[model samples]
Target: SQQGEEDPQALSIQEGENATMNCSYKTSINNLQWYRQNSGRGLVHLILIRSNEREKHSGRLRVTLDTSKKSSSLLITASRAADTASYFCATPISNFGNEKLTFGTGTRLTIIP
Candidate 1:
């Protein structure tokens, strides 16, 4: 399926701490994206790191992609209670001329205050 699978299905950390999650995929991809969902809310795009790029940062969020390992990692520094959410990693799959995103098994993160 080439779908990514996130490790540590669930995680809990104190506020102001850092949170990290890992995602592993079965096949090669051009880029990977991270998304966050807060409870009943929809998924919000966090970051995207391309295969050619080793690392990228957006605000307090840092994303790293290792093409050789077929894996990616997401880091949220100084996490807050508001950061509590389910995080998913997505990879694009091309079928014919169309492209769609396939998501990973999410990691539920709880930031304790």
Candidate 2:
């Protein structure tokens, strides 16, 4: 089974609005990371929140984790059309020397021009 899944496979919003997405996963992980991908481009790391961390923020992005439920949430404040892209969450295996990350199908976010 895949480790992570993002709800609302698709999201559409107007410019300047906020966007939020939820991710659920199975199994334990050392850390989870958020990434953004633009068309024909590689994914860029947005934030990495460890299991011990409940919340983290970077610029307009906020991420919260609930280890008890193996879930996480991402909040983006002041969205822009530039934010239009696919968002993915990755759960890195919890073990020393582990280097693999399982990714979610992703949520395609659309911001109106």
Candidate 3:
């Protein structure tokens, strides 16, 4: 499957704590992106890391990519209850102008106050 696998399917943490999620893929990819979905509804794009990039940071989020190992990790620092959601890693599928995003098995996070 082109879709990757995310570890620790679920996590529960206290507010202000840090949350981390890991993903591993099987094949080569041009880029990797992370998203958050609330209540199984809309997805909010968080970060994108290209194959050439080893790491990136945005606000409270940090993303790391290791193409050599075909793995990625997302870290959310000082998480809040509002951060509770299901997070997914996505890669692209393309063919002759046709492109689609394929998502990995997601990690559900719950933050308690």
Best by lDDT: 3
Model 2 agreement with the true structure over 46-76: per-residue lDDT tens digits? 9999989999999999999999999999999
**What's each prediction's TM-score?**
0.97, 0.93, 0.96
The sequence of per-residue lDDT tens digits that candidate 1 reaches over residues 11-96 is: 99999999999999988788899999999699999998888999999999999999888989999999999999999999998889
Error of 3 at 109 (Å): 0.2
Q: Evaluated with TM-score, which candidate comes out highest?
A: 1
By TM-score, the candidates rank as 1, 3, 2
Per-residue accuracy of model 3 over 10-89 as CA lDDT, tens digit each: 99999999999999988888999999999989999999999999999999999999999999999999999999999999
Itemize residue pairs with steric clashes in candidate 1.
none
| Model 1 misplaced regions, further than 4 Å | none
Task: Tell how far residue 113 is off in model 2, in angstroms.
Answer: 2.4
Please list the C-alpha lDDT of all candidates, in the order they appear. Answer: 0.94, 0.91, 0.95
**Per-residue lDDT of 104 in model 3:** 93
Q: With candidate 2 superimposed using the best TM-score fit, by how many Å does residue 20's alpha carbon deviate from the native?
A: 0.4
